[model samples]
Target: MKDVARVIVTYDCPRNCPNCCNEHIGDVPAVKFEDLLKYKELVITGGEPMEIAPRVVEMIHRLQANGYNGKLWLYTSCLKTTKWADRAVLQAVNGITYTLHHKPSQKDLSDVCKLNKYLLENLDNRAHDRSDRLLIDSRCYTEEVLRIIGLYDTGTKHWSSIKPLEWKDDECPIPDNEELIYYDLERV
Candidate 1:
């Protein structure tokens, strides 16, 4: 497993990606800065972290203040970074990963791309004294599971059929006689 802790701070996102495990995440406690100490990298995710920009900034500041010098990675939709305050928060983080999902309109993509361009330019200028860790979707992984099984091609559809897992009948909830099969789509 990767030596990274994915701390999800909120279950409230504007776009409900079909593959998201947000329902299972529930209302977990907000992350304290100390929670990041055990890992080399800390990924602050959410329904969308930008949903609570001020709180995110506080988390970053707290981690920095406590002398936790690990790399901080932010996973966001790039929707809220359009605001100056949110951009400032992004400027503080070491790296960012933008989530690419179903965009209903070209305008949405345009706005996100605009912010992406700005972050690429501003967050990587050594002459301007910013960190050199600005990133797009550069995940170091052997495999990726595109869980678009429940995804819609467009619009506000959600994963209504797949509810959060529930324990029942004194056993885990796999079908009694079903054999689970996994397929390897590609090899890295």
Candidate 2:
């Protein structure tokens, strides 16, 4: 697979999710148009890309205008409001890999489900052709982070990294019944 240039646009996100890597809320710098033009795959991510949906849409439009034909992906926590997820934003993005945190509350699950439904309903039918483009990255293992490299569903062509708050080598083991699958996104 050809290597694609990727960038994490901002650290600022809307949710105060427990497992968030960015601990504090702050301003997320707008990705320079030139920088967006240089990459084959541009991943617009942040505390919540939806917070800056207007700017994100502008960035995507600019990229397309610049002849960037490569896939576009969004790494989102999906905690933002649905109004921000208008068709224009969905049209600009190729796929979304929603990060599902471990032991999330029922409210959180409901929120995610709602967001997913909105994405599925509002986007064009051709968006389904890009269903391989959407994914749910459920953070499964706190131990055996390496094993995570294999937990993906090959059919979906999506995977997520799991990081435990407390990890000790050889302390936790994966269950025997568990099956491992590898996904190749480039193929999708």
Candidate 3:
């Protein structure tokens, strides 16, 4: 566990968003699974991570299997694929924050509710709180959208929340002394 790092899993997104910064970045070198163990927190972001869902989870499993106990948080819109609903998406990582650019309909909110409930029932809250979250575009943020999705009673002040979006430019710069291994971004 050392410095914080963000692995730009990929820039190849299916949607062309006005606020998206994926296309603004340079060539992203593929990252190594072992190299990822150096960070205390690894933020897995991309054009859309769920686009390559299986590989994403595989890398997560690999990290945990190798005794990496640090935080593994992912950033995705969950718009392109249903892979977000996969069990390991929540189980394998400490958190998955869905940054959506569009307004969520009743159906979409309901689906999120269903998944949040499922995670609450199955995961070990005693160890980790429900870090899964939703980030609606600030333009899409409505007063009615600010409701408690769920609360975790594991003595940790954590719960799934719907909030406005924040951008850190297009992508994070690769840190010094660290190779930006792309193993989880592309097919390994």
TM-score of each: 0.58, 0.55, 0.68
Instruction: Indicate the residue-level lDDT of 116 in model 3.
Output: 52
Per-model CA lDDT versus the true structure: 0.50, 0.48, 0.62
> What range of 10 consecutive residues in model 2 has the weakest lDDT sum?
179-188
Error of 3 at 123 (Å): 5.0
- The alpha-carbon deviation from the true structure for residue 38 of candidate 1, after best TM-score superposition, in angstroms, is 2.7
- Which runs in model 2 stand beyond 4 Å of their true positions? 17-19, 22-31, 79-81, 84-87, 103-107, 119-127, 132-188
Off by over 4 Å in 3: 79-85, 103-113, 119-128, 143-161, 166-181
Ranking by lDDT: 3, 1, 2
Return the top candidate by lDDT. 3
For model 1, residues 1-188, the per-residue Cα lDDT tens digits are 23666666665787765556555433444433444565666667666878777777776776788887877766676455568657767778675665444433455455544554564455544334333221222221111211221112221121111122222223322233322121111110
Clashing residue pairs for model 1: none
Give the better candidate number (1 or 2) by lDDT: 1
Candidates by TM-score, descending order = 3, 1, 2
Clashes of each: 0, 2, 6
